[model samples]
Target: SDVIEFPSSIGKVTFTHKAHQELLKDCQKCHASPAGGTIAGFDKDWAHKTCKGCHVEMKKGPVSCKECHKK
Candidate 1:
């Protein structure tokens, strides 16, 4: 239920964990852990690959950079 902020070369991406929890039924949908962890290892390439992949597969969520990233 915390705001997970990930700082990147472009900007900081603030992800609302609580909002996702309401939409998704499983924790592993985005998170690799039940307790969650730092986004230090989650880079742009990783996000584009993982996030966009899921979005394309499920036909939901945003795949655009500006949609998730702050200008």
Candidate 2:
């Protein structure tokens, strides 16, 4: 139940690893590498894009800033 936090101007973004794992069974969903391996070392922009993209497509989860960032 490790929570990864990212610094932001609005607020820190706390990502719940357990929750994401529960929702996405495969790690590749977000950790997919260009070489088709593992470990992409994605940055904040990539995370924001991927997360918001999936959330937008699934029509579930939070896409808004305030929803994820602490206000």
Candidate 3:
């Protein structure tokens, strides 16, 4: 089947609808365009660099290796 965004990627990341809905009070909170102000949404300036950028700023980006992969 064709992937929604990146079809040629190694594999598709499955979504946990119920869990996400329960976890995230607002979809726009995490999924938004450049008009919402969050780097996840707006693209105005460095102020809003999105989750990845924000996390990186906090020394918590995925590149940290231990942020989410800690044992």
Candidate 4:
């Protein structure tokens, strides 16, 4: 799917796969090695670390609670 929604207690996080693919152009960045399938350890901390960490490093994307976790 182009867009994936993650339901959370704080809010629903809507992720645009196509956008990231176009921007990063690397499946390994978010996927597993060798083939790009399910992530190894996916969880809240992992998301905050990998996803938000990337945003922080790249100086783009949402990095705040309200920015990602919408009510």
TM-score of each: 0.67, 0.78, 0.31, 0.90
Clashes of each: 0, 0, 5, 0
Q: How accurate is candidate 2 locally (lDDT)?
A: 0.77
Give candidate 3's error at residue 16 in angstroms.
0.8
Better of 2 and 4 by TM-score: 4
Instruction: Estimate the Cα RMSD of every predicted model relative to the unseen true structure.
Output: 2.6, 3.4, 8.5, 1.2
The alpha-carbon deviation from the true structure for residue 52 of candidate 2, after best TM-score superposition, in angstroms, is: 0.7
Top-TM-score structure, candidate number:
4
lDDT per residue as tens, model 1, 1-71: 46778787787788777777777767776668766655446777877887778778889887777778795
Q: lDDT (0-100) at residue 48 of candidate 1?
A: 86
Task: Give the Å shift of residue 70 in candidate 3.
Answer: 19
lDDT tens digits by residue: candidate 3, 2-41: 2112121333333244454465456564556423332332
The deviation in Å at residue 64 for candidate 4 is 0.3
Query: Which ranges in model 1 have alpha carbons more than 4 Å from their true place?
Result: 32-41
Query: lDDT of each structure?
Result: 0.75, 0.77, 0.39, 0.87
The numbered model that scores best in lDDT is 4
Backbone clash pairs for candidate 2 read: none
lDDT score at residue 44, model 4, on the 0-100 scale: 89
Runs in model 3 lying further than 4 Å from the true structure = 1-8, 31-71
Tens digit per residue, CA lDDT, model 4, 23-64: 898888988773666677788899999999999999999999
Q: After best superposition, candidate 4 residue 28: deviation in angstroms?
A: 0.8
Alpha-carbon error at 61 in model 2, in Å? 0.9
Question: Model 1: which residue pairs collide?
Answer: none
Weakest 10 consecutive residues of candidate 1 by summed lDDT:
34-43
